[model samples]
Each structure stands twice: as C-alpha cells, then as structure tokens.
Target: MSKRINSPDTEADITLRTYLDIYPHVCFNMIAGAGSGKTTSLIKALSHIVQNHGAKLKMRGQHVACITYTEIAAREIWDDVGNSPLIDVSTIHSFLWKIIRPFQKDIKDWVIERVGEKIKEREERINRSGTRATTKEKLRKEINKLNRQANAVEKVPFFNYGTGSSYDNGILGHDDIIKMAVSYLNSSEVLRKIIGQKYPYIFVDESQDTFPEIVEALSLVRITNGDRFCLGFFGDPMQKIYPSGIGDLPGDREWKIIKKPENFRCSKEVLDVINNIRRTGDGLEQTQGNKTVGSARIFVLPLVDEQQRTEYLRKVQEKCVSISDDQLWLADGHVKILVLVHRMAAKRLKFPKLFAAMNDNAPLSFKNGLTDGSAWPLAFFLKFVLPLATTKLKGDNTMVMRMLRAHSPRLNKEQLKGTEVRQALEQLKVGLDMLVKQLGDGSQSTVLDVLNTLKNTDMVKLDERLIRYMEGNAEETDELEDDEEGKEALSMQNFFAVPAVEFWGYLKYYNNQSPFATQQGVKGAQFDRVITILDDDEGKHAQFSYDKYFGLKELSTDDSKNVKEGKDYVIPRTRRLFYVSCSRAKKHLVVIYYTADVEKAIMNIKRMKIFPEEQIFKVEDLN
Candidate 1:
C-alpha cells in the first residue's frame, strides 16, 4: 500500500540510495534540488523499513516522525506514506503538541506561574480604575495595532498561550517544537528510552531549510539514544530559499554529507541560467537530463518615475493576457508571479501600486459571514476573536443570532431598528448558551440541525442578476470538500449564505493572507506571471539591496554597501532584484518602463544580460 515510487536512473537516485544504505544507525544529509523527488525517496525508505525491518525493529509502537514546515506539506507527505502499515508522519508542531498534551496541566501551571507576574503588570497598566474611555480606546488600539504589525512582519502573533508574547519572548515558533522535544529527551532519560524503543527511525525532510536549533535537537537525540535511532536528513542547499535556513552539510561524528547534483526540474537552458547565478569557485557542476517541459526567459524593466511604474504595470497585465492565451494557463487561474524589489524603499513604493493592480483586476470575493477580503482574516478571527467573544458572552447564543437577524429581511423596517437589534442579540446569546451546553452533553449536533431547520424557514433568495453585475459574472462554488466522516466542516451554502456562528469560525480561522504588508508578504509564494513597478525616487535603488532594508544586515555588506553609495549602486541590486522577481514567473515575464528612463534601464539590462538589447523597449516605441 506504500505510495512511494522507485527512484529513476539518475544522479539523484544514486545519491538517495547512498543515504538510505547508511541510514537508521548513521546520519546522512542528501542535498537535492527542488522537485528532485526527495520526499519520494523518504517515503520509499520508510516503506522499506516497515516491510523489511518492522519485526526486527520492534519499535514499541512508535511511529516514524516526519517533520515539515507547513501543514500542507505534512499532509502531502502523509499521502505519500499512503496507508503504510508501519510509518507515522506529522508536522513537528503537531507532533510536539501530541507529546506534550498528556502533561498539559503541569506544563500550563508551570508556564502561567512563571509568567504570571509579567502578565499582571501589563494588565494593570491598561485597566486602571476611573480610566477615560478615550484613554482605554487609545491603549487598546495601540495593542491591536502592534499585534497586527507584528503578525504582518514576523508571521507570529503577539500572544502565544503556550509561550507568552512571541515578540519580546525569545521562543522559537515552529522550530521550537523540535527544540522542546529535544529538551524532553535531555531532561528525561526514561522518555528518551521510550521514544527510542517506539520509533527507531527519524527522517527530517527539507533539511536545508531547517534551523540550527532543530539540528542541535536531533544531535542530542542521537547522542542520548545511542545507536537505537537512525536519522536521515534530506535537502539541497542550493534550494535554501528561506532567510534563516541552515545550509550546513553533514559532518564529523555520526554524520555523513552526500551531494545530489541533478537537474531534474529544469531544461539544459534553464540549468545554464541557474548555474550562472550559483556559480562560485566551488566547481559545482550542473547535471543535465530529466529536463522540464517548458521554456523560461528573464526580463528587465526600467522605471524612471511613478508614471513609468504605472505604465510598466500595464505592460505586465498585457503579458499575462498573452501568456494565458499561449502557454502556462492552469484550471484555477492561479498565476505564480514574483515581484522582487531591490530596496526597502522600492518595496514600500511599488508594492502599493502592485497590490492595487491585483485588487483592481481580481477584486476579492468573500463568504457572507467572513471578512470582505481573503480567508486569512477569517482564520485570524477564529484564533483570537472567537474565544474572546465566547468568554465575554457567557453562554449567550445571541452573538451569531443577531448577525443573522441583521442580514435577514423577515422583520419590517421599523422592527429592524436599534432596540430590535439589541433584543435580537440578547436572544442569540441565550441560544448560543443552550447550543454549547447541549453540545457539551453530546446533543450539540442535534441542536445544530434543529437550529438550521428553524433558520431556513426565513431564508430568501435574492436576485442573482444584480449581484453578478456588481461583483462580476463569476461562478459560485463550494469551497470545502466532504470528509470521509460525512461531517460537514465547511460548505459554500453555509459559509456564503447562512450568517451562522459556524460561518464566523470559518472566516476567523481559515484566512491565509500573505504575512508581510508589501512584496515580502508574497515571498516564498509563486505566481504564473509577474509585473513589477519601480518607484521613481532615490530610494528606488535600495530595492536591489533587499538584505539591507529587510534586516539581513549580515548580507548587506561590502559590495552591497558600495552599490548603495555609488551613483549606479542601485542599478546592480535593482537588476538583480528584477531578475529574482522575473525568475519567479513560471511562464512569462513582462517589464515596463518610462520612455525617458527606458535607456538607463536598458543599459543596466544589457549589462546584466537578462535579455538581448533588441528586446528593450520605450513607451512610445510600444505602439
């Protein structure tokens, strides 16, 4: 039942096999490029262990712990394990939560007692007696704004009930899961023995992106558990796209590093381009064969001022249309576009225009109870707002009911006035309390069904023609799929039409907006095509030195510094940033520039050799 496929006859295969041969007792690193079947190899290795070594291993019912960065990636790996009899895979965070949940009371008590004094101080500062409403509002707004800003920049919300303030606290986010696990291993020899007896093998995927903390944790496990556990770390340093990625190869005691120099996801031409960028004196050769099925071209755009940036965006839209008509169109119409700004200033300036363009072209459409924007807001609300509201309402069901009534037209105009809203909200509160109590007693589903049946009596369908005209002629479809248990978790009908409490949960907990405000928000995410609009300011050049502006102070040294100081300092970073942006496009790259700055951008483009001089264009020349 293993879903793993055999490795193809290539350098990648040879490299993977070498690691598996020495695995279990030994630690080996397989640095394979993106789309190089690293996950496939891990699955195959796990299958081998399960089928051949399960009895010999006698792993005390311990499952293979496969750690990944995202929930989506973890699910993908779980699928790859494919109904395997022996293997167990999960995200590191989920795995830690499972292990720690048993000791939750002790852990919670310890953390709360330790951090109690700090929390008390903060609460007292804001909730002083006789405080003016304006003062309280200002403080609350400040707290909310700071929390939002932190979420945007760090992808970490202000509060983590598990670890306190994520901002001031030095707690690791996802990576800390492994760190905590390692701490448990070190603290309890019995726990280590239990884990060692249960799961004999550990596979860490995407090792290149792993942090030093995770690496250290794994090392501790190996040292403490002796030879009972086997570790396999797989990743490619060249594909270390994350800023804090630990690109170290395996070395020294109990560690072996193996190179996987294969170009399976790109054609020879594409490999050539990749090699040129990665070329150092290291003599790392690019492997050919297993070529990708498409062609790739890099482009550069010149923008002398804001006017030029606008025109460039227009050109990008035109290119998207062309690419859609020709090649690289997907069923979902999700184009992976990357707009790389060279400096912090450029990102600040250009990102707004870029976002506006995307919004103008693809206005966000949300479910009725959800926020008007994307799903991310709903996810946030579910995580923070729902619990707080539930606690405040004190078993009242009226919160959700009032929202439903507001949207419903069952009541007459006068009846829909202020007092009615308040009374209806009160009813909703009571109803929610009853629903929660019934659910706690295992009658919640029955109550939910009864409530839905009653609410449907007043349901009315509005004319679709007007909605279509106002929101564009887009087809409506259910967003959630039916699970095997037949439990309706989320549905378009309930989510889009019914203003239920469940809908609020869907909006608050499922939103996936980009964490950063500008281009950084879209980092690590890909689009089909990209259009970049450069700001027409002195700071525009800073976009090229992303490391400097984005707090990568370590990388923004020497040459990057000189580039910032020199007259043409901006050109190199700008051109490089543009290349990074354009390279993110899977199919097409379009550049737009002002008629005046066309020559300057073209000269930089020619110098960088992104495209031939003939391809460079001016605004007037386009027609």
Candidate 2:
C-alpha cells in the first residue's frame, strides 16, 4: 500500500480515500476520467479496506466485491490485490451469477415470470394497429416458445452460464443471467440481504458500462442494509462507449460523486486535446499527472475510393513520421489505426460479410462473447486450426502428431491394432490435406465450406450447437426476423454463411495480429502513436454519428427534434467515443477525417477549435 493511500492529505468530504475510510456509511460514485488512475485508486482502496477492516470482514465471513467489465480486467485487479480472498474480483457476469447461483428456485421462478412478461409484451405489440400478418406469426411463434419455456423451467434441475442455452438442458444465456439477477435482486428482499451479508462493500469498475438496472439493484441492497453495505462505482461518463451502458448515471441525491480530475496516463499535449473534445460534452477539465509533453494533429481529406484512400493514408503516415521525427510511426503493429466500427475495420482488412454479420442488430453482449472465445467455432479456429495450419506450413509433423494425440478421437482409443492406428492417422492426414488445400491457396472460404471439409474427420470434432445452426438454418435462412432473439440467431446463421477467411481476418484484428482496430474494441488500451479514422459514412451504424458530433455534417431532422426534446443520444455517445480514441495516444495522436466536402468540413472543424490551425492539416484531393 502506498503512503498516499494510507495517509491522505485532503478534506474528508472531498477525498475518495476519506469516504472509504468512512466505510459502510459511505456510498458514492467516483468519476474517474480518461487516463485517470482509477484502477490504482481501486487497488489502494482495497488495501486500505484490508488494513482497516479485513480481519473483521473475515471474521464475519464477508469480503469486498469488485466487479469489473472483462476477465482480463478482473485478473489484473486480482493480481494487483495479491489475489486476496478478502477482495473478490470477477467480471460482471461471473459476479452476478455467483450471487444469484445459489438461489435455483428463485432463478427458475424469475425465468418463468420473465417468459410470461415477454409473451404479454409481444401480445400487446400484436394488438397494436397496423400489425402485419408475418409479424403476427413470428410473435405467435415467440409466444409459443416462451410458453413452452415457462412450463419446462419449473422442472429444470439447475441453470448454468458459459454454456449453450437450452430450454431442456437448463442452460442460460449471458444476457439472461444479468436480467435474472437484477430482476431477482429488485423483487426479492431476501436475495438483497444475502448479498449484503456476503459482500459488505461492493465496488463496480467501469460502472458506466454496467447495466443501469444492476447499478440500481446494488443501490437497493445499500438501501436495504443501510450503513452495513457500502457501494462505490468507479468510471467516467465520458468513457461510456458501449451501447447498453448507463451513459450518464442518473442523478442520485444519496450518493456523493467523487471526481478524480488528474490523468495519470497521457502527456500534456495529448491530454489537452482530449480535454477540449470533452468540453462540449461533460466540461470536465483534466490536469496531467506527468510533466511529459505530447503532440496531436487532425488531417482532413476529401472522400476517395478504396485505392485512393489507401494512398492517402500512406501519405498521412509519412506526415506523422515527419512531425514526430520517429521512424516508428511508419512501422506496422507499432501504431494502432483505430476506426469507427468493426465494419470499417473489416473493410480495411478485407472482411465485409463477417463484420456485417457481427454488427447485426442484436445484443452487443453476444458479439463480445464471440471474441471472448465463448463461441465454439471461433474458439476452435483459434485453438486448433490456426496452430495446426502454422505447423503444417512449417513442415513440423511432430507438432501435428502432438495435437492429434491430444484431440484426435481415433488415436485416443486403447488396444488399437497397428492397421487401425495407421487408418486413423490416414484419415487425419486426409482431413489436414483438405484443410490445407483450401487454406493454402489463400482462398476466403465460407465457414460452412471449412466445416464440410473437416466434418468427416474424427480429429476435428464440431460443437453440436454449431452443427445444429448450420443444418437447422440451412432452410429459411434468408428471411428477415421480427423477433429480437430471432434476429440474434439469424446473425449466427449469416455469420456461418460468410467466408471462413473473413473470420480469420476477424480474429486477426481481434487478437491484435492486425494493426487496425475499432474504437469501441480498444477501450482502456494505450498506444505510443494512434491514428483514428473518423469516417461516419463507413461506420454504417445508426446509433452513433461522428460527423454530426464533430460538426462535419448536419444533424438529421429526428436528431434536431430529439435534441429539442432533450432525448438526444448521438452527441453524448459520439463525444465519449472520440474522447476515448484520442486519449489512447501516449506520445502522439493523428485523427484523419474522410469527408464529402474538404473546404466545408475543414471550416467546420476549425470553428470547433478542437485543433489549432497549424496542428490541423488540409489534404489535397487524392484523385
């Protein structure tokens, strides 16, 4: 524990440490801005709790719960807290499930109630005027499905997460667990009391990204337990980029908002640019923690075709190299080129269909799950195919044999004759040959084609869900869906229909094997130099419009209406996103705007004063 955390130098009412010092009685939200030392403060707070109240909590069988956004983040906090048992660190889903897991009966009941509510909701929607027959039929099917689940849920032995959702098998979906947990916590006082008793002090990292209902439910626990439970949310409204997050937390008179105004990450110049970008939104000024200076520039270029755009990017890179006087600016994988969305990244890297499928209008949570290796086909490719392909290309048959021994079903059988062993090896060899033959030509094959190529081999076992999706949706796959769940399922169907090569590209960018990344995907990650592409036309998402936020484009009629009604989302969302992207640069930042009008866009940007005249560049037509 640092002395700064242990011995504070500020007023008790203003300092975050002082509030934790008044633990159990203190419940608040800590507004830690971009590059703010939020995690460091969190760790220090955990240490203070341990030093001050760890023994008492241990005696009472209670612990401090820190629910983070990702598993990687959880692990980092866990490692920082010395893997302390007193501090329970886990991802949001894991933590929610852990609290709600023991109440199987409640989960079952809640799920049934949830199904009833959905059925009623859909019925009401169908009752509305102008209901189409096709929509009516789809809603009827969804209602029928929910009815079946309501009946079956009562007999379900137990529910499980991180597995395929099955009405018969009692497996729950990712969103369901969160919904179920929050609903139960809201409705059941006993569950809230149990949670408060188990974890007396709960701190949610990236709380802005947490569902508003979860935050509210935790607040319920605090209210129920009174001073016995302390709840703190650590995140910045400016950093809330996810679609489902509680953008700006609703005003709570009970909770004190602690602002950490100093950024411990970015240098002065880089920090100044972000602070300016945030001024129009939150108006929260940030002071640099370090004395180091940085550089920032914005380049405006006329809209061009793919080939010309590529050349323009190269010229911009050359300019970045000149300004920084560092050859590393031109190096691949050294500078992250952040785009507006996955489609932009996919277009840049040559994977249109896969990216589009992933961006389908379903739960963003599921798409996130695919990258977390929860999706079997994706997981199989990363774990089995990529490694085996690399080894086969290297002519390392020994590694192939090793992977075969581990995964090959035929080779695992005992008391097999030499002939049978040879036969198994021959089958695997043939399978590998087929896979290699398809992939070796650098062809972008569909996942279905790859699955078909490997389906006969015993070594390349497929998940039943993947198989079912492939076979089940083969018919009627092109029909549009009216139901939300139907839409999500169709996304998977469309994904499987896309080229396997697109998935390779998807994972390549996902794993940082490629230099281009989506702004939403690179949250909390810093680079020495960052190149952010702000092309709203390429973004293709209706939810966020960077052009409108940056004044390069006019707001739509509905947008202007929403602003007048005080229901606007575009400005706040885009502002937060742009702030996040610009703040990722440690020493240098470059923002390239691909606009329809060079002069008009440049004039609008100059008027905005996000960057001064010299720092902003106007590129000639890249014809």
Tell me, by lDDT, which candidate is best. Answer: 2
For TM-score, the strongest prediction is 2
Native-vs-model 1 lDDT? 0.46
> What is the TM-score of each predicted model, taking all chains together?
0.56, 0.91
Summarize candidate 2's per-residue lDDT along 1-623 as a digit string, tens digits.
Answer: 34434433223223766777774577888887877777777877787788888989999999999999988989988888777889999988899899888888877777777778888988997899998998777677777777777788888888887533555457777778887888788888988899899998999999889988888888899889988788988888898887778877788787888888887678888898999898898899988876777788988887888787788888988887776688887887788999887767777777788666755664454567555555544667778877887788789999989987887767876846769988888888988887776665477677777777667787666777667677773233233355445665777777778876666676677678888988887888898889999887777777788777767667888888888998746877788889999999888898998888778887888888888678888775222
Q: Model 1, range 151-234, lDDT digits (tens) per residue?
A: 443432222322112232323233334545556656777766666666667888777667666676666666777767777787
Error of 2 at 470 (Å): 3.0
Off by over 4 Å in 2: 1-14, 115-155, 362-365, 370-373, 414-418, 473-480, 621-623
For model 2, give the 10-residue run with minimal summed lDDT.
Answer: 4-13
